[model samples]
Target chain A: MRAVAVGQAELKLFWRNRTALFNSLLMPLLLVPVLIAVDASGVPLVIGLVGFALLMAVYYNLVTTFVARREELVLKRLRVGELTDPEILVGAALPSVVIALGQMVLYCLVVAVVTGVDLPSRPWFLLLGVLGGVAIFVLLAAASSAFTRTVEMAQVTSLPILMACLFGSGMMFPLTNLPEVLAKVLQYLPLTPVLQLLNAAWADGPVIKPLTVVAVWIVLGTYAVQKWFRWDPRR
Target chain B: MTAIEVRGLTRRYSGGFEAVRGVSFEVERGEMFALLGTNGAGKTSTVEVVEGLSRPAEGTVRVLGHDPFAERAQVRPRMGVMLQEGGFPPDLTAFEAARMWAGTLTSPRPVDEALEMVDLTHRATVRVKQLSGGERRRLDLALALLGKPEVLFLDEPTTGLDPESRRNTWELIRALLREGVTVLLTTHYLEEAQALADRLAIMHRGRIVAQGTVSEVVDAYPSRISFVPPAGVTLPFVVDAEPSGRVTLRTNSLQSSLHELLAWAHLNNVELSGLDARSASLEEAFLAIAEEAA
Candidate 1:
């Protein structure tokens, strides 16, 4: 309940920041449609782009919310109350995480209906990918804010994943396209395995290949990000 | 009984800064205790540890008989804290924020009642972002009171408040005390401390210089009577007489001392000027102590 309350409060603030919402939602509309022009024929292209939009609308935007709260000393203030550390953090992350989940579902629906993007062979693989991708990225975003000096720095701090998921989160090119060695390396990048799991699930490819790989990234990414997260803004 | 008992509390930051070096104090139940200190004097560090937001680098802090760091769950639900910076989310209406906090407590005061206590019922629907600085502080205090907490920690609660707002906050706190709520407030405003605290501890650097009732602590210093001297009309030798003005003398005694000086002065050539006597207040005592510590 505490976590829900915190998340709900964060969600309200997230909606109120008009510029952030416009950029996270509408700005992507213009570019994604244009970007989707090149490979409208392939279902993988649409799935990948939808994944990118989820990361944009949900994952990336949530980072700024937590970053702004920490900068404002909201997290520190919340800590002084009855809330435990986990309660405070989980509550803070809940709103964005829920939004990310909703956006992913919406994106999946939009692609399936409009572009006739087919369903995944292994539904569990895509489900794991969606949940795991959000989990890993939320932690990574928090960890990223430790280095971010201000909310403005959130844009720059998030660029690495923004670009990586573009080329690496498996939302852009399939890891299979690169040289065997490089493909294997890119497959292990933070979003690579999750995106691949999603892609594999969507295409009904052998589920085991992406599932085993994606699971490792999720576990490893979640561990690394939580261990390194800094809730207090240094000023 | 002690509502707050801190023993050898120490807080050493990661950058080799020992902000609080073994500081400790106690606040009796239902007493208004003030933690008085200047900026960067380890006050914030010590208070954070007490609020259970940070662990002490050494020693123990117990609020209402529960260790704040080790037994946070026990202390947390029973206490309310208002930190240096107000923490209410800006988008929520004041009423919503109060109600949300009320949901977290085991035995909370009604949301409307808490708002009414702070005189913020009129602004219940106002968005937190829309509130003025003083209104926001009242809201922060309102949230702290939502739980009807037994122990309330207010750090600089009146920092940005106007005189009227500060007085209102003082009255609200006084009412809480009347209802037997234990308050631990930190403020640099000596008058605020003097007005509210039944007992207070003055901090210099990371150590307490004095701790007691205001009258007891302030009366530890010298009381003085200052009056214009009757030229060449002083009788009886005075111990610590400071006469700097053209004809002014500050003496340790007010009654008998004033009478003797006046009688002698009347027989002589000068008339006593602007006679006034005062005991050192907590403010005077605090400034004197801080200067010496500096």
Candidate 2:
């Protein structure tokens, strides 16, 4: 309940900053639409939308929240209170995670209505994919934040992961079309299991092989968070 | 029970530079105690250990009779802290931050009440980023005052305040002290220590060099009179003559010293330049101790 209240205020603050809202939302709406127009087959369209969710919900939210808090020293201050260490971190991230979740839902709904695509058949895989994606990105963001000395550094810090996800996550090209060696290598990338799970979950028969891979990635991401997340401003 | 007790509290950074050198002190309940030092004196490190923010590498710290590091929850709800870093979330409004802090405590003062206490009620709606430096300090104070904390840890709470704001904060602190709140304050400002602290410790080179009641420590040093002996003539008392040609008399009795000086000066038919009598001030004791430690 407390996290939700904080999340609501965070969302309001995000909205108040018009330019941040534009950067966070515009990339998805415009990029996905352009991809849909180019393909016209709609398969690439849905994949592009899912990719957008991963970027904003998990990657962007995580990085921005981490950098902002670090610069402000908010995490250090929160540690002195009654809140436990985990609670302090998780609570601060809750707001961004919630925003990410809301954006994903809204994106999916908009894509469905405009493109005439139905909801996923199995839904469980997509559900797990989105939730697991959120967890993965949130953790990765914290890990990435360790390298980020300042909020101005966040843009550069986030670029590598963004580029890696764009090419390696099979959003630009179908995973089945990739060379077997490359496909196997990319399988370990954090976004691969998420996209694979979403794709499998959306298919008529429902493939669940991505479940194990995603679970492993979740563990890896969480380990990184535990090991590298910095609570204090170094300077 | 001691509000705070530290034993061999030392903190060494990862680079092997020791910040706090096994310093320890106990803050009795319901009194204002200050840790005095210039910047980089490790006063912050000592207090942060007591506040349960940093784990001292070698020492043990107890607040309310529970180890702060091992038993954070046990001490957290009972104490309030304003750290050296005024780390406020930029997105948080003053009221929201206060309310969120209030939620953390099992028992807390109402958010508005805390704000009102710090004179931040008018600016409660403003986002933290919009606040002035001193306003942010008040917001920090408001957070520290939440839970009507039994013990408060304040690390340079008046750093950026104007004189009016500083005086107001002092008055507010006095009110809290009257209500029996145990306060532990840290500051570089000497006047702040004299005005508010009943007891204080001065730290230098990561160790406390002096700790006692204001008068107790000062009384240990001789009260002094600084003056230029008129016409370079000798005075009755033994004087520590300075390079500046000003004579300092280290007298045990201030009243008798003053009496003797006035009588002698009248009989000698000379008036001294810049005659100033000082009963051993806390500032003098602070300088002496810090200089000795350094």
Candidate 3:
């Protein structure tokens, strides 16, 4: 209940800043069309775009927000309350996760209509991918924030995962089109399994490997958060 | 009942610097206890331990009969903390921030009431980033008050405020004190300590150098009685007589020194002009201690 209140307040604050609102909404809205234009098909493009949106909204956005809040002492103030450590992190991440999920659904509908792609054959697989992706990215954001000292440093620290996901997660190009060795390597990146699961759901392909890889990422991400998460600003 | 108790509290940083070294003090219920100190004097470190934000390297801290660190859940709900620096998110308006803070507590006062108490109702809609420094301090105060806490910790609450705003804050704190709130505050402003603190401890170099009521602390130093006696009148109790026809006397008891000088003047039918008698001020005492520590 307290987490919901904190999340609502965080959402209000996020939307009030017009620049942040524009960036969060516009990037996904514009990126989906660009991906469709490049691929000339909607299914794979929509999946990649959904993954991309999750990365921006859940991972990058939250990493910066957590860093900024910690530097500003907002996290410290919240810690003084009855709110537990997990409650504070999960609560702050709630708004971004909701935004990403909403954007994913909106993009899927738009892409399906524009490119005449059929609905997913296995919607449950897509749901698993989206939910798992959001959870993984949120945990990664908290883990990343542990190392970020300031908002400026957040920008630099977020780049590696972001760039890795952009290329290796099959957002820009399909993993199958790459060399065999490269495809195998890129498939192990954090967002790869999520994107593959989403694409498989769209195309009715096999889901076993992608599901297993995503579950592995979730476990790894959870462990990272537990090990490295910092609630206070570095002195 | 004691509101706060610290025994041999010490905090040492990783780089071999000890910020607080075996400092101890107690604040009784309904009392205003101030911690006055210079920069890096361990006032903040001590308060942070008492607030349960940090653990003491050694010793114990109890707030309202519970160990603040080991038993924060029992104490935090009834305690309020106002840090010396940024704690509010800069993007939120004052009303939104206060409302959010109110949501965290069990039985918070109304957000509007808290805002009005800090004289921030007019700025309630203003973003924290846009508010002036004094307004920001007021917002911090409002959040601390939102929980309706019984024990309040204010760290330099009026540091950024102008004279008028500072006095307004003092008035609000005084009102809370009247309602039996236990306040523990740290400040570099000696006047503020003297004005609000029922009893205070002055810390220097990680230890308290003076602790008592304002008058008691000031009384530990000598009082001065300076005057120029009439011509041909040798005044008693004159410790120093300069060639410029000025006589100055240092006394532990200003009243007795004044009486002896007046009696001597009356007996000789001579008048003493330009008489001045006053004990040391808190500022003087603080400066003396700080210099001694240095």
TM-score of chain B of each: 0.90, 0.92, 0.90
lDDT of 3 by residue, B113-232 (tens): 999999999999898889999999999899889888999999999988999999999999999999999999999999999889999999998998899999989998878787787677
Give the alpha carbon lDDT tens digit for every residue of A113-208 in model 2.
777876677788778888888778877888899888887788899898888887788887766688999888887777887888777766743345
The Cα error of candidate 3 at residue B260, in Å, is 3.2
DockQ of every candidate: 0.59, 0.59, 0.61
* Residue A151 displacement (Å), model 2: 1.8
Off by over 4 Å in 2: A37-44, A204-209, B236-245
Residue pairs of candidate 2 with colliding backbone atoms? none
* Top candidate, metric lDDT: 3
On TM-score, the stronger of 1 and 2 is: 2
DockQ of 1: 0.59
Could you tell me the lDDT of residue B23 within candidate 3? 91
Q: Interface root mean square deviation for model 1, in Å? A: 1.8
lDDT of 2: 0.80
* Model 1: per-residue Cα lDDT over A191-234, one tens digit each: 67676677667565555665676567667656765677666777
- TM-score of every candidate relative to the true structure: 0.92, 0.93, 0.90
Whose DockQ is greatest here?
3
